[model samples]
Target: MAMRVLETITNMTQLCQKIVHINIRWSVLNKVPFFRQSFRFLWDRILMCSVGKSIQYRRLHRCASSPSPAAIECKFASGDPTTTCTDYDKDSDLVALKISLLGDCQIGKTSFVIKYVGDEQEHRCLQTTGLNLMDKTLFIKGARIAFSIWDVGGDHRSLDHVPVACKDAEAILFMFDLTSRCTLNSIIGWHRQARKWNQMAIPIIIGTKFDDFVQLPLDMQWTIVSQARMYTKAMKATLFFSSATHNINVNKIFKFITAKLFNLPWTVERNLTIGEPIIDY
Candidate 1:
């Protein structure tokens, strides 16, 4: 019985690899009929297999509505696994996604991620010379989903990591310090660099340190937000103002991504009030 189970598992692995190969060759093949049948077969087999770990969702709300993304340009799967996640995710059948965070130095990229993944997981994050990698898993309808986040340091020396970080990423977040216009201005260059590797990754503009931003004069806030909105329109990306300290818009950002990807209904209103954090599409 043990040998039989091993053979079945091995066959399942090979089938999954073939399906992934088809996805990689999608544009070149353009064989809709073949892919349709292939995926149908794959799904039937997957549904019958009852293996993989169960992870609890991290404050993820039950989504009832269909997903509505701001734009649909390109898509890519996760790159080669860079680091092993905590044991919590091993052997799990969760849909793993790659997310990239790019910005100038000390723009709160690490803090933003730490808040979402939690402090314990933060300690397990791999801190290399120029990159940081963290993983988080969420449970949805008994199925598990994982996000392997790549944070490229915002200095010139760390620029080499951009291509690796962006490659195969499903989403790329271009972050900036809300109090510094210069950091915000750096978004154009960062966007250009990232687009070189993956053009289809969902783009998101995030302004960090909202707690400090609100203390500025209302006129200054208006000017900054106006510029941010312009940038968002230019990139055709979603815009969000967040504070890791206060946990403002931090969770909502990931929730938005999940909803958009899964076609789940999301009810988020645009907030343009000067004193409040902004969420504009």
Candidate 2:
């Protein structure tokens, strides 16, 4: 009986080896470019499986009524896996959000991001040459949210560069300074151009530096609010005002984004427990 079982196991191993060899040859026999494309397709399909760790919609909502984004775009350079996350398993939808801040130079776009990410105050306020990116893992209810936030230069000269920044975004946050009427006026043109380029559904209009003036005239504030509301309503977007310096309504902006992008309830404290420390899963 032992000899018979050993013979069966050896035969099975040999068969498996032959099958693998045949598959390798078959894969290589295809055109080299075709083989390369097929390999990439398979790799992306495998990564899509990780979406199981991401949000799983109970029901698909209409485009007009969907609370969260339909996809998420993770930022990963050619060889940098340290920053990008792949914790989700198969069958996950990738939500891609492209956000760009446009206003005159020194409108506090970088400051807003630093505050949102809770970066140190003295951290070098380096002018974003082209684009800067930061990732934040958000929790909407118990669901995991990974957002890639891109901070683009807001100078008018950068307007030509905006399309590249806003390309393929599921949502966008258009921010302008509360105190600068010129900055406020530019939003209309910017919004029109961005909509033409991206044609995205989810958008947010933000007024930054609310704490700059003790009290902005009611009419001035209302005018800015009305302008933003008009555009947001036209684009079907949410609107908000925030101060990154004082940390006022910063969480509110995040909550709005989480709710809009993931359709999940917002919470300040995260409840995720670290199991075994994964060196590299």
TM-score of each: 0.71, 0.57
Tens-digit lDDT track of model 2 for 189-231: 7778778778754677677787863377766666665665676
* Window of ten residues with lowest summed lDDT in model 1: 71-80
Which portions of model 2 show Cα errors greater than 4 Å? 1-98, 120-128, 139-143, 265-281
The most accurate candidate by TM-score is 1
Candidate 1 lDDT by residue in tens digits, 1-281: 99999999999999999999988888657777788999998875675454321112221234222324332111111111322234553543446778999999989999999988878788888999889999886644444567899999999999999999999888999999999999999999999999999998899999999999999999999999999999999999999999999988887788778667665655467998889999999
Model 1 residue runs over 4 Å out of place are 1-92
Please, what is the whole-model Cα lDDT of each candidate in the order they appear?
0.81, 0.58
